[model samples]
Target: MEIRQLRHFVAVVTEGSFTAAARAELIVQSALSTSVRNLERELGAELFDRTGRRVVLTEAGRALLPQARQLLAGAEAARQAVAQVSGLGAGRLAIGTIQTLTCVDLAGELAAFHREFPAVQVSVREAPVEELIDGLRAGELDLAFLAPDARRLPDGLAPFATWQEDLVLVTAPGHPLAAAGRTLIRDLAAEPFIDFKAGTGLETAVRRLAAHCGLERRITCDVTQIGLLVDLVRAGIGVAIVPRRIGEAAGLPCVRIRQPEPGRSIVLAGRAPRPRNPAAGALLDQLDRLDRFDRLDQLDRLD
Candidate 1:
């Protein structure tokens, strides 16, 4: 029988009469009776003994009472579960990020999300921009933080938020470049550079800037992690051009680039038109709230 029928049956049993059950259910007594009758007919069993002033359960009614109550309870539980997910109370959120996370504090945002929706499971993945885009396309990720090339995003993904950031030259404390208050792009043309792998957006921006200045980059070391690149610079292996925020965080000596300054637009990307996950929608709502108050910088303060 239908859930509605089961619900009416349970209400009648609890209220001890069809008239009271109808009043409790906000329905007419005759309609309630019809529903109960239809359910009894479907089950091929008499659910109540009506030969007395007050309605009471028969043998078959007693047998089905527990099962009908269980069915109704289960249906209610299902509705509540869906409501929790729709309201962002519980679910899993998969977030992807580019290897370098200088533009925004991804961990902090995750922490904020956790504080707000503790029951939601958050998963983070670090990869190259291309790989992040692939993950988005494949529906493996709910959101991504990336430095897109010239505002060029993947076909289906749209930028939720974007900000421009400059790239700076980083070196050891006593390095020759550090002594120079400011450096020009041409000055580092022949210097040994610690660069990211070829497929990274950072590397592409470096190469583009180098090409603009008519110089070929001499990559002494190739690294994947920004922290590792900073460590290499600290050890005097070679210099690196990275986001200013990264250099500042590393506490390395940073020199401003004068000519062909390398920079990129960082964006929070997600599926356009619609997001498949309810948790993703909730995260986007949080992001929107943060954006409205210009509080994105506050993410840096979170651990």
Candidate 2:
């Protein structure tokens, strides 16, 4: 049957009477009644058994009710998908991220996004992984870049993309373990350590590593900024665990953890739902383009 006819059919079932459905649909009662009648005629079954004032659904009507609703819902979703991709009007994107984003250059991507979609207001919040997850669940943030704790994520949060990276122990030039080819966690039990504040991704992962090795880390210093944490390590405040790429880039001694080698997943996560924010969708599209360009550059190098 026609979509309009199905819409009218659902309205009548909802209001329980032709008069009420007509008022609800903002049409004349006769028109609503005619639409339902036409639908019934096409199906070759009497839908509603009209008893005095209240309308009751017949067998045919009961079966059709669910399918009719499904069709209508599908139609609405299609319409929204089309509208979102057609254009981006004025909007805003509230984004959250972790302190260490070594895998992807979010700053550079956001800068490019700003130049292209200047009308879209974008705000970034840097927080620990736990806080970022809470923000997404509470609807305070639209999307987040996180070093997720392994592959598990909250039920409603889904990753848009994931990149793997190694976590290495960083120490200054003069530290005793700095020159070790590969060290074990038990070897550092007595040494002072520099670690990120609790609730952070790196700290949590490092703590898990310590627990696995059955040793408590002597965290003599706690820092919020990754750069500051690295600097402290450079100055011999204490040894710290950091991303391999970041530690190497900082010119620090990055020793591999031979036992229980820890790795991290850098993921771009968003809430699982239909009709995502148009601005967020635009950002994803932009990232896709940039990723394609990066792949092309890699291929050129190979050539």
Residue-wise C-alpha lDDT for candidate 1, range 232-281, written one tens digit per residue: 99999999989898889889998988876678767777778546676777
For candidate 1, give the lDDT of residue 75. Answer: 64
How far is each candidate from the true structure, as Cα RMSD in Å?
19.2, 15.0
**What is the C-alpha lDDT profile of model 2 across 148-192, one tens digit per residue?**
765567778776766767999999886777766589888888878
Give me the runs in candidate 2 sitting further than 4 Å from their true place: 1-86, 292-303
lDDT at 90 for candidate 2? 56
What are the clash counts of all predictions, listed in order? 0, 0
Worst 10 residues of 2 by lDDT: 294-303
Reference-based lDDT, each prediction: 0.79, 0.78
Flag clash pairs in model 1.
Answer: none
